[model samples]
Target: MTCSEKMGSFYSGITCQDIPPHVMKKARLTLFDFLCVLRLGAKYTVINPIIKRYLVSLEHPEKYTVLGLKMKSSLEHAVLGMSVVSHGVELDDGHLSSATHPAVAVIPAALAMAEKCHSNLRDLLVSIVVGYDCMIRFAKAINPKHLSLGFHSTSTCGTLGAACAAGWLLGLDSEQLSHALGIAALQSAGLQEMLHENASIKPFQVGKSSSAGIIAAELAALGSKSPSKVFEGQYGWFNAMSNNDYRETDLWDRLGKHWMIMDTYVKLYPSCRYAHAAIDSALELYDEGYRMSNVKNVKLYLFQQGINEVGVFKVPSQYEDALFSVAYSIAIAFQYGKVRIEEIASNLQNTRILEFADNIDIISDKQMTDSFPREAGSRIIFEDDNGNIVVRENKRARADFDTPLTDEEYLLKAAQILENVVHRKYIDVLWEKVVLSDQKMDVKEIIELMNEMGA
Candidate 1:
């Protein structure tokens, strides 16, 4: 079978029971994380507001609730807005191998489509699993080369994932879903240049991917025809996007035996995933009683991809700048012994943090470069004026597939993330009514609760 047909059949065939219990549990955690991040992200001063304003200006038909906005919108508008909001804080769940943020790209579209179609909890969850698999597979086949080519995997590959999710929720047959996947492939567009030219475009691409995916699925449901060989065709996604530099990995080796969502990592800090190991190492130094006062200079060694993405030594002038800067993230870790949203927001202009960030140097290490997108390792060395030196290395970040966070840890992260943005009572109710429960949920009710309670 062709790549799109294989993926279309797989994405269209998954059911709630076919998904293992552990995979469903992971889906619940991802959904809960997405909701929390979406709520907190609405309060962001940058990208969310621009999206909200632009959507409101369009005045799309009101069909669904926009979380944290206290407004109603069409399914497309809601999906676009929620998807963008989820990534606003930079804490969305990401997969290492795929190099994409799956939740932001998948959940918003799936949930919005579920609500629109009145799909049960089973359909929603199953669609999520399928979406992650399709999106991650597309990315795993093309990235870090795709990323090296200045394409944002989350935005590009995510489009296909979102289409798979929406098509499954819409009950499209395998053939129809193939068309949806093809349409989504044609619509895929995101640039890593957004990281420098405008960070707002990062989340904007995510939102657009989700919205465009829904449109693709809807078009396919209307019996629209699409190119069949969207993946392996002569001038298709693999060739055009990856410049024929894609890997030939088995896209369906284990299939249901190995769900891609299981390999996804949850973020502990609200910065780029590349910066997480550096932050973790810095916190370890802080825990060892190494304060900034005693440290003279710091050097961080990271993989080439990490250095290319977040290892810049520039001082952050705003919140967006800080999110992608390993130097700034580490500075926050050492200065406060933690990297919290509050610390990031309050210290954007702090001279101490900026000065410390200036002293920090990020170097690309050959060993780490060779092991990247798998190990994501980082090494840090600290020196004192008197020649005292300390070194630490993190082979992999916490919350990785191997070192997954417990359910309690996930809940605690939710609380920590939402403490300032959402009311305490709402957080409690959400945890109990939505996340902790396994029963079928009224999708509309959950969306309503989010609309009323978020922000």
Candidate 2:
């Protein structure tokens, strides 16, 4: 069978009962994290251009709620806003295996489609699982090469994934769902060139992808036809997007059997997942008495993926560059004891952080390749005046499935992200009303609650 057929059948087969409780919890946090980032990102200047370009001049239909803005928006515009915000902060949930920001691409699209269909919490969770599974699995089928080929996996794979969720919500049959996937695949657009140039297009691509999913589904339902063999055709996404040396792996290997959200990694720090392992090691060292005071130079023996993405920028000059800069992320960790959006934004001219970041080295090593995606493993070396004060190697990030964040931690994180933007009472209400429970949710009501609770 064709890849599209396989995935369409898979999406058609999954029921709310097919998903486990733990996966449900993971899906809830995935949704919650998207909301948190949306709350925090609403204030960013980066978000202004998008809002003005879309919401200011164009009229909104007042069908859905944007996280912070009081203006009611259509489902497409709402998803667009959510996608922009979720990816804007760099705090979105990631699928390690696919190297794609899963939640930013999937959750927003799911929310928009769910809102449109008035889908319950159970089906919403199930749709998210299908969407995430489709995206991450397709990404895995054409990864490091997909990165190497200059395509951002989040946008490319997310298009198809979002289509699955949207198609499911819109009640599209397998054939229509296949067409939706095809049309969504046709809309796949993202380039890593922005990473090198410090452009905002990366997040914009995610926003576009999120909206495109529903559009594809709507068009498909209206009898739009596309290449059914969009995935494994002679010029399929994998080979067309990646290097010619591509083999289409089982993108739908376990589909309904194992959910993808269960394997997602939550960002403990608001930076690239690539820097998480090294940052964790640095923090652990500080905890073990290797404080940031006497550090001279730091070395990170990183997986190929990490080295490829964040290795070049020793010092970032613009807003986007700093977000992707390995040195900038690690510097903020050691110097400020955390990686905050303000630190990266306001400290662009901080010489001390720049010099320290310049002292850091990210070397690509093959030993960590096997553990890559599944684990963002790193080996770190710290040099101080005392000479080689610490050496940390062979460690993966803590947010892996084994050491997942607790409910208390997620609530605290939610409170922290919302502390400055939304009131504490609303944050608590949101946690109790939406995230903590597994009941049918009126997304519009939650949005109203947040709007009422905004500081």
Candidate 3:
């Protein structure tokens, strides 16, 4: 069988009953995280309002509701808008192995499709599991190389994931799902160049992939044919995208037995995943009584990839720059001993953060570079005016599977995002509905609950 066929056959057969209880639990957690980030992004981020207004101006058929907003639009546009909003703040769930954000890409497409089809909660959960599997497997198979080649796998591999979820919701069989994957492969696109340019439209690229995935699945359901060997053909995705630098084992190893959603992570900070380890390490130094006023110089050591990405931004003027800047995050961690949305937003004009950011130097360490994609480690050196230095290093960030957040931690995070934006009652109800309840529920109920919120 071709790559897409094998993946489709395995994933299309995964019903809610077949999914293990643990995997379902992880799916709920990620779903809750997605909704929380979606709300925060819509209300807090500047880009979401502009995108919503543009979509509203288009005046497409108001068949679907955009979460955290009072507007409704067509299915594709609604998913597009919501996907952008979900990733707007960079606090959405991500996978280290693939170096991609799956929930932001997959959940919005799946949720919109589920609402359009009135799918049951069980099926929605199953689709989410399979979607994460497809997206992470494809990216893990081809990346570090795929990512090094300047492609944004969240939009590239994420298109296939979104297609599978939407196709499953539409009741597509294995064959149709394979066709959808093939169609999505042709539509997959995004770049890492935006990071260099400091563009805020990075989230828009993610949203376009979600929209493309939905279109691909709809076309496949209508009998549109596509190449079955879309992943392995001579001119297929692997060769064309990964330059043939990929691992076959990463694609199919323990496919049905090991769920990729279990390997995913939820973020506590609204910054690039690469910068989290450094922030954590810096916070540790702060705990040891190293205030910004006492520190004379700072040095941060990170993987070459991390340095290549986050280390580029020394000073941040806007949201995108601040989210991707390791120096700014470290400065925030030292200056405030915390990095939250309000802290980051309010400190952009603070001369202290800017000065501390300027004094911090980022270095690429070979040891850290080799440990990447498994553990995003960092080492920090702080030197005081008296010539005394303190160093701290973290092998990994705090929110990985080994150091997973507690149920209470997840709830606290959700409450922080939903506070003052939605009623406290709605937040509790959403938590119960998504993470606690298993009763027969239509996806539209979730949509209606979210519609009560607005930016």
Candidate 4:
């Protein structure tokens, strides 16, 4: 079968039992990471205003946790709320190969749907694995150059993943699932132009795509018919959007044998994934006790892919720009020795960060450029005042799944986020329930608990 055919079959036929144990464990970690990011995102200047505006306009009550907030909305509203929280901070998980924020797009839909259905924890876990699988598979089929051409994978591939997860949870047959995929394909949209304009529409793309996928699945379940060959038919997604043909067999090459979730990397810093390696390199120089002032110039050697994505910010005037700027991220890490979420939000425009950013230079290495997709690496060289030199090269950061955060560290991060958005006591309770419990809880009860905790 072609890649598209294999993916179609997997989404249409895979059952909960088909999920491997290692995949399930990774899914759980993803869940915890998603919640942590969501909680922290609730306070993001861009995300909070929109969520509050929507909540104020609501006339009826519904069930579903709105991350750190206490307000509950309908299932659809819940998906939107959670999605905004997930993507607002730009701290969600991203695929190293695809450069797509799969969890941000897929997790919100799964959580909203699972809450609406009151599905068991096992079922929820299974749905997340399936959702991630579909998202990564679709992303893998597309060319990275397509994104450079202004397409946003978070919305495009994310919609298909959301549809697959919703279809699975809704108990739709393979035919209905295919129909849902077709419906989802029609609604997918997000563009790289938002980054250029520094618009807040980026997160909206994630929420909109996610909610749209749920709507597609619901319509399919209600007997709505859509084109069967949404992926491979003439003038379909690949041909229309990318102008490239895909090998459909690549979609299910390993199926259950290899898990996509295991390849996902969590963020230690609340910046773009493209900026992480540079930040790591700069941090290493700091750990070696190099003074920022003594550094005459800093040169960053990055893969072409990283440069294309984050090298846009030659001079960043705002927080969003700084987040996407390799120069800014490296400068801040070298100056302060660390990059935290609060620092990104508040100090992106600080005079010191700007001055340091001015001294930083970024260049692409042809050798490193050749290793694209399979790995993300960076090399930093520092020139000191006395003609001294220091260098550090990191193949990958610690947050990569292969070198994941410890359980205590994960919980501590989660707790810190909760403390920022909700009451400490409530966060403690919710943490216990999410981490220790095996039974499913009502979506309504979950919302109520968050409300009591000052949602």
Top-scoring candidate (lDDT): 3
- Candidate 3 C-alpha lDDT tens digits along 218-306: 99999997897888999999998899999999988998889888998889898898889888888888897888888876888999989
**Candidate 4 weakest lDDT stretch, 10 residues:** 1-10
Off by over 4 Å in 4: 1-9, 54-65, 415-431, 439-455
Pitting candidate 2 against candidate 4, the one with the higher TM-score is: 2
lDDT of 1 by residue, 1-455 (tens): 88878778877887777998888888878887888888888887378767778889987898876675667788888888888888878999999988999999899899889888887676788899899988998899897788888889999988899999999999899999999999999999998877775675688888899999989999999999788887888988898788988876747768878889998999999899998988999999889877777787788899998887786535877788778888988888888898877888889779988898888878889999999877898999989657988889998888898789998898889888878777778877777756676547767767777867754
Compose the digit string of candidate 4's lDDT tens values, residues 9-118: 66767776788766776776677678767767766737567665777598647565666555667766677777876787777888877668888788778877887787
Q: Ten consecutive residues with minimal summed lDDT in candidate 1?
A: 433-442
Better of 2 and 3 by TM-score: 3
| lDDT (Cα, tens digit) per residue for candidate 2, span 308-394 | 677767788877777778778777777767567777888889888888888787788887877776667788887876785578864
What's the distance in Å from true for residue 342, model 1?
A: 1.1
Give candidate 2's whole-model lDDT: 0.76
Task: Give candidate 3 regions above 4 Å deviation.
Answer: none
Question: Which model, 3 or 4, shows the larger lDDT?
Answer: 3
lDDT of 4 at 415: 67
Native-referenced Cα lDDT, model 1: 0.84
Which candidate, 1 or 4, has the higher TM-score?
Answer: 1
Give the Cα lDDT of each candidate.
0.84, 0.76, 0.86, 0.74
